[model samples]
Target: MPTAATVPYKPANRCIYLHGFASSPRSRKAVYLKDRFAKTGIKLEIPDLNQGDFTHLTLTRQITQTAALFNNFNIPITLIGSSFGGLTSAWLAEKYTQVQKLILLAPAFGFPSSWFHKFPQAELKQWQESGYKDIYHYGKDKLLPLHYEFLRDGNQYDTNKLKRSLPTIIIHGKNDDVVPIEVSHQYISSHSTAKLIALDSDHGLNDVQEIIWQEIQDFC
Candidate 1:
């Protein structure tokens, strides 16, 4: 139940909220955190990773676009990312010294490798041969065409390379079906600065949002 007004803040500190894949700036968590930050006159930057085109979305494109936001500002930043965005934030923190802290929710660590098992071998081969696959976009509320390049580009980023020791907090649902809580467990085990909080909820984590917010407040 922590609000931005209750949390200590510095005028120059920057905070950006990154939504999950197939989601947008208008996502439930993004909007809720933005509103809470606004209560204390803090601006939370929520950029649409889709960039007006979800068809050709890739992890590289998202990382480049999100990193561009740090161009002119020399101030320390706090990144809050959910699902795939959590993966993005981790890379951003690795590449940029300006990112002082991170709050990750249900981070998709093993990503495409983790997801590939969900589809049959023939289905996966068909997606590669067909060049694109139909995916359910939660933000658009429809099945959209996503190119196979998403998998190829994602393979370029190895989570093993994320060795920076920036303070990080990962809140993952114990009952998450999409990305296993074991991913966070492995991440926290390797990074001494990282902490994992297992919540009693599912993947979407709508029920434990307030607890997540409280964790974020304390971590920040």
Candidate 2:
């Protein structure tokens, strides 16, 4: 990943980059993309999705927070979201017409439900019964206590509800263990205006940032 100081500057275009779950604006991918956009003289607005409180994080909060950024612009803006943020972007685009374009990276299409199968039945039950579960926070480099309300809130969002069609591109890793590429495949099948670019990488997609950038350039 490129290590460069994030220089504050005026934005040449209306573009927002939303980081993944348990991540901050300073994530490697966020910083890398910020640097790339800076090189193009474009300032990418990255909001700290954590909101200084990851324990109480939920998808609804992410959507509400990100929506506030472009709500009053009264103009179309592009959105780039990764993982859980990607899911948030899709929901935002569905609800708000201001989101004109979307660039999703390994979007968590089927989330809380998909997660049910990943963990053991006993573990899932314990999480619900205990009211909280400890998840490894990538940005903090430690396990953090996440409230069970997160899962409860996520259940309200169904990927099947996404019916809005706009200029959208999804870049997903073929070997993604977190959110499977099949999810993107299913997503593309429904939306006629969306396309999928499967790459040879994992969930992080760090090794293929250049390729991702190139795709973004072409898409934009």
Best by lDDT: 2
Report the lDDT of model 1 for residue 61. Answer: 94
Task: Pull out the clashing pairs in model 1.
Answer: none
Separate clash counts for every candidate: 0, 0
lDDT of 2 by residue, 113-219 (tens): 98888789999899999988999999999999999889899999999999998889999999999999999999999999999999999999999999999999998
Tens digits of per-residue lDDT for model 1, 92-201: 88877778889999999988788688889999899999999999999999999999999989988889889888789999999999999998999998999999999999
- Computed on alpha carbons, the lDDT of every model, listed in order, comes to 0.87, 0.89
Off by over 4 Å in 2: 1-13
**Candidate 1, overall lDDT?**
0.87
CA shift of 9, model 1, Å: 12
Worst 10 residues of 2 by lDDT: 1-10
